[model samples]
Target: MTDHNTAEWWRQAAVYQIYPRSFADANGDGIGDIPGIVSRADYLAELGIDAVWLSPFYPSALADGGYDVADYRDVDPRLGTLEDFDRMVAALHARGIRVVVDIVPNHTSDQHAWFQEALAAGRGSAARDRYIFREGTGPDGSLPPSDWVSTFGGAAWERVADGQWYFHHFAVEQPDLNWSNPEVREDFLTTLRFWSDRGVDGFRIDVAHMLTKDFPDPLPSRAELDAMPQDGAHPLLDRDDVHEVYAEWRAVFNSYDPPRTAVAEAWVRTPERRAKYASAESLGQAFNFDLLEADFDAEAFRHIIADNLAQAAATGSSTTWVLSNHDVTRHATRYGLPPLNGRAEKQGAAWVRAGGPEDQLDRETGLRRARAATMLLLGLPGSTYLYQGEELGLHEVADIAADERQDPAFFRGGEYDGLGRDGCRVPLPWSASGESFGFGAGRSHLPQPAWFADAAVEVQAADPSSTLSLYRRALGLRRRLQTDEGLEWVDTGRSDVLRFRRPNGWEVITNFGTSEHEIGEEANRIVLGELRDGRLPGENTVWLALRA
Candidate 1:
């Protein structure tokens, strides 16, 4: 096991993200609970990750996949009680793995006590002041407050029975909290301390850039919502006032002995705007999604890496890199399709449906690029987040039936196609054959594809060259490198090749072209993953150890 001695541990940590409902099922029920996570502590420790960032397990109605939080203090009964959460944290800590919990401060479930109180107390009450409530437009208060669109889809504003329209950037069930309210700020600070005092190492702030909004009028037009100014001039998102909220949160974080940290899940207009979340006075780190959104081109990867690193440097904070998360399509299936064509985000359900036929997914080709991309990502200079089952090379279950879909965005967004995040959040296959593939005693919540048995942990653990083994080896090797230091780009003189040298004579080279490149004997190297008779194959990455 790795030592947890460094105070700046997060800067170089390899964090594994666990979707609570799908990681493991200890009980006979189909859902994965905190005890299920406790039972799998050894597996995570063996995987060589320094921390585990669990998705929200707070009390919720399961709208927006548990993102619509009802209570931040207690755990959901289906997942387990608050005591079970404490035990889970202790078990992971005993195994040298830190715990980072999801904090959904941007919004709350419609059933949350505050929201319900607001609804029952009617308009012009103090309970209504904690959230963004606005008077509807038009003669009879029938129209929405503004023309802003929800990120999920449709109108961003949802009207209540009290003749007031509430704002929600995501699903209608999630009412956006008003950060301008002192009571709301104080309540969240209390929540932060409540969890930190319970021994959580850090937090993953959801929708970190969108806590504040410009209300009443003069909102951004539909055209303007497509792109905001780089200097944080957006009318509704990444506004100058949002950082004040984070700064207050930073104060709460610093009150603890170890000084807890946070990572922002903000998707801003530009790298400069995104970097503000991780500035010296704000969150410890913000996800650099530009790397995840880039295509499979060598130049695209290099440019994204360079730009992200520069932005993080400007903020005096470490960069965070992630490939697959709960929100977007998994990289395994995404890489198999055509190049992204400069698309920087997941294009919604209808777009995925119109992309192609499901039978044409090049699984083998996708797995190869996924492995190569992982090697390249791990070799970079920052903290890395690995979504659960990414090591298993699990493809997206694209054919989920319409009735089985659960994402609020899929149903509320008015999409006819059954496209939703349920595809990537399918219950994992542990054994090759079993009821639910050993996920639980009952059938999985989302149907696992017939091919999942091939990618099961039991099938891959025994194979030395499997994707799971490669990740184990790569993570183990990554721990030994001077990863937190700066990287020097190597001029390979080929647009399709990316070569960068780390501080400790560790060089990473990836070939995006469809040709093999032979390495000379002068650079006696110990290859990490890709080694084909001293030649690096296309769509493959190799880590080399140069002689000092």
Candidate 2:
């Protein structure tokens, strides 16, 4: 059993991110719930992950796929109640898997009591003060208060019957709260305690960088906002003010018996800016998305690895690495595309929109690179997060019908115009063939493709060389290599290859070239995954344990 006193167990942990609605469904409800997660505790334990990070399951309008939380203290009925949540946590704990839940503190659903009251209380009321409400500019107050645009699309401000405009970073239904208000800060603290008291291990903070807004005199236009220098202060997003909020949250976490922890989903521009969210006084870790955004190039990866490790060390924080999440396309599909060629920033929500021809996507090639990437990621010396079904080599469901697409981005910018995140959130496949591929007893909330049968857990489990087995083997072996030490580069004089030596004499090497690379006779290596013909094939990674 993991000792709660360790307090730093998250430093080198492997966390599985379970998008509740897509993970598993125990009942015939078509939606994954707490009971389903409870039943899968054994599967997770066998997968050898250290913890499970559950995406938002709180009461929500699902305007942003549960990011529009209605109640921070209660569970959504579709997912389950607080009782089911407690039971799920207990079941996971019995199997030695920690539970880390998603916390969306930046906004609340329009259906939330606070938001509802704010809408009825009219402008200048105390209820309205809890949220970012302003009078629209212009003659008739018809125009929005600012030119700021939503992260999903369209205008960020929405007008109410009271002639006031409210700010929402994502959807009109998700109103951003005023963090500057003492009541808002205190209420979040109460919410944090509610989960901590319930024995939750940690939290993955959503919109962690966008919590603080500077309210620029004339809010920047969409283009200007996107082009603003992340190094300097901005009107909204990653402002210095956000750190103050995390610092206080850290204090609350420290007050707990073992001191709960947090990882921020802060997508800042530079490694330096990302480090600020993971400093000793703030959240314990901030996901370094630079690695996820890296192109399939050795030089690009090497630079990101070195920069991220350096930044984490400087801040006394653990480096968090993740390849894919609910919001982005799976790396398998991503790697299948042409290399970004230093245009990694283009890999945003609209990646699929700018994608090449369907024939250009080499799924087989992408799967090979994904296996190699997993080895490289697992071999690193820090925390790693794996999205659900990624172990089964699940690619993004590209053909999600317009009617089935649920992401707010897809609707905010007109149907099909904005390729939403629904593709990545397809229900996972557990069986080779079933009504919903064993995702649930009924129709899945999001339809699974017929191709999912090939990647089903049942099919992959029987195949020793499948990606599921690769993840299981890698994770089972990772426990022995856990450490806070950073990685060191092993120069092989090849620009297309990346070789890094861990402190334990374990070397991780990946060849990005189109040719096979020789494994020196002097080196004794364990074939990690997807190695071709006993040699390190192009886009393959292997781990070497140098013998004395």
Candidate 3:
């Protein structure tokens, strides 16, 4: 069992992210609920994760996939009651797992009571002061307030009948809250206390760097903003004012008995700015997305790891490693496809839509590389966040019909114009045969392709060579091997090979070249991968313990 009293347990923990809507469905209602999560408590414990970061389950319209929260203190009736949420917390805690719920402070749903009041109270009222509302530009206020564009696409300003426009960084249904308002700031504190009181161990702040904005009288166009130096404070994102908000939040977290923690989903451009969010005075940790955006090349991975470690060291915070999440294509599928061109930011969603070209898509190679990457990630020296279904080596389901699509980004004309994140958000397959592949008794909200049956948990659980089995063994061993908090790079003499040794004599070597590499040193035993004739094959990783 884990010692909850241990200082900074998260620094060396393995956290699994659960998209609540797709994890499991206990009521056979085609949607996963809190009750469903309760049912999978044992499964999560068996996965050997120290904590689970649950995506938002608050009342929402699901505009932008629940980032648009309608209520901060209640559960969505469709999902379950507050009692059910309490039960889920208890179930996970009973199994020695911590709970981290998502907190969306950047924006709120249009359906929220505050937004509704803002609309009815009209322009210049105290209600309207809670959110950013401004007079539109152009004749008779017919245009948007400024040239700012939504990250999801389209204009960032949405007009109401009162001739005023409200700002939104995402979809029209989500209005950006004015953090400068005392009421707005105080309400979020209330929200933090409410969840902390419910026994939630931590929070994952969505768009953590975007809570504050400094819009100039004449906002710059998207092109102008893109060309400007991102290292400095910006008009809409990563401004200096944002850190003060988290500083207040940190105080609330410290009030708890164990001192609740938080991780920020900040996408700041530079490493220096990113470290500020993860500083001891702010959120405890911030996600390092450099690894997620890297190519499957040894040199690229080396640089990313080195940079992230340096940033973590500077801030006195733990580094975070993540390969896949709900917002992007699964790494297994990405490794199978060719390198992307101008649309690289989309992560090959368009390539998947083009049928994954039979000649170019190498499934076997992709899975092999994915396994190697997992070994490298687990062997690292800090927190690791694993997306659900990745343990089963699940790839993206690119063939969902258009009519069945959700994801608000799909309708927006940006990187997600032709395809959105639904492909990665499909329900997990538990059984080899069922209408929803044992996800539930009824049909899933999204369609599960026929190929899911082959990768179902039931099929992989019994196969020793299967990805699921590998994860089980790797996680079990990770607990014992993660004794050191730092690693030294070993000189493999090959640019395509990577070797890093932990202080405890455990080493990890990965070959990204086209040919096999010799194992030049003696080891006590191979803990993860096998060696063919004392050599490691390309696109493979092996864990070893050096002899004393």
Candidate 4:
């Protein structure tokens, strides 16, 4: 943890991330792009987000759905042009919103220029130093230095046509970059400067934890990591001397003004380590997988929050909590259903490409829960990341066929757990008008989700009771509150009910529990909006100001 005494304002801000492929397609090419996102900035500002984070627009093989970077500086032609991004950035800035972009430094596409250089150099070459290589024989004579498995499954090492193995923690096509190399560091820093100069407010550093693995050697088996212990680093993660690499990047990010830097991803595995990374001194912020990993235990959640706050105190660092993002099963599918046979088995309307629609979760129940969830997201401690369409309570889409799926995770792990991301990545619904498929007439990059026809934004805008209206109101309330200056940084009272009382005298209270419960030690003052008894209507909450 660095110094919160002088932390940047973005530290107190909330951000929204848009997966471009699914945001809205203007060209009708079945893909969402910069222009499409620019069109929605007006609506986004209505949500009162501090900034916008557009997933990578870099040119790529689309190997890992854009994580595989073939080129860093250029936008994918399919998405749009460099000018389109310039306009999008300008438009958001015009609205007083800050911005961040994804930077996958841990690795690059195998087709990346650096990787190509390494491939040609083979072993005992300068470029080869940019990646890990081991000399050994395997049972099959075609295996990794050891039996390490990639996050996507199978061996971590992939054989090149030259009979050499390159390591990839994820999909083989997405080769992991070696941070230990000075040249690699220089190149990435230059890239950072390139964008920061372009006015990007910050970055959501992808795989920040894995930026450096001190020594490249054979790793323990998955069984070993899973069996040994959860206390230390999960052997699969936590390589030695990682701090040096982060320190380097931290130094670089610090050199900029307003810092224009935000680091978020699933990197920290333990509280002590999480604190070290999120420490104001190390990296800007880290995405809390703790919240996403929580099973439906209110006590567990209470414990997680308690520990996170305590850790923040321990390191004088910042802590963040998130419900869902582009990578996971949408929150509706994960938390909306009642515990059936010990888990929420009902597929919260997950998309199944060409597999037809799912009616298990209806509009009223789903939308209400969505409203309730968004309320929690905004009211939670620390900064928030709002996934696109979540404001309207979108559900998991149909499971696209394996052949049509683009996510490498789906392709690597086979069926079942490998469900394609199409459900969560489908096009956004923007209007009820005929032929207005989300972002007007442009070629769609992917098939439109079924809700686009009637459940569009225009239809919801006219109805005060619509979820869109709920979102606007929520954002308005968020904008109106301003007591952050006086609140205790690590308050843990009202455990089951996450509570934050701002110096502005406004109390942001949420009921993450299943049943209703009354808060406040005394009679409530004028309710900001309608109230349902002392409790909100099902896991809901209200924003209030105390009256003396």
The TM-score leader among the candidates is 3
RMSD of each: 2.5, 2.5, 2.2, 4.5
Clashes of each: 0, 0, 0, 36
Report the candidate with higher lDDT, 1 versus 2: 2
**lDDT digits (tens) for residues 1-548 of candidate 1:** 22345667788789999999998988868888899999889889889898999999998899888999998899999999999999999999998899999999889999999999999998889999999898887899898877877877889899998799998888889999988899999999999999999999999999898888666355556676657564565666788788888999999888877789799998787777777788758887998876566667888888888887888788888788887888767787877887667454345334343223467778788888888889988898888999999999987888887799888666766432347678888889988898788888878877888888999988998999899999999988887764545889988777888999887778898888878877666236865855577777898888887655
Poorest 10 consecutive residues by lDDT, candidate 4: 347-356
Q: By TM-score, how accurate is candidate 2?
A: 0.95
Clashing pairs in 3: none
User: Where is model 1 poorest over a 10-residue stretch in terms of lDDT?
Assistant: 348-357
Candidate 2's C-alpha runs over 4 A off are: 1-5, 216-232, 342-349, 352-357, 414-417, 530-534, 546-548
Estimate the TM-score of every prediction.
Answer: 0.94, 0.95, 0.96, 0.86
Q: Write the per-residue lDDT of candidate 2 for residues 1-548, one digit (tens) a residue.
A: 22223778898889999999999999978999999998888899989998999999999888888989999999999898999999999999999899999999889999999999998888789999999998898999999987777767788899999789999887889999999898999999999999999999999999799887777666667688778876637777688888888889999999997899999988787777888889879897999887666667888888878877888889998898888888777888888988666454444435643233357789988888888888888988778999998999988787877898898777776322446778889999999788999989888999899999999999999999899999998888677654446578888778998988887777789998879887756344573544455567888888776554
RMSD value for candidate 3: 2.2
Candidate 4 wrong stretches, greater than 4 Å: 1-7, 136-141, 214-219, 225-236, 295-298, 338-367, 414-418, 433-436, 440-443, 485-500, 509-529, 532-535
Tens digits of lDDT, candidate 3, 223-266: 88777765547777788788899999999999988889899999
Error of 4 at 358 (Å): 5.3
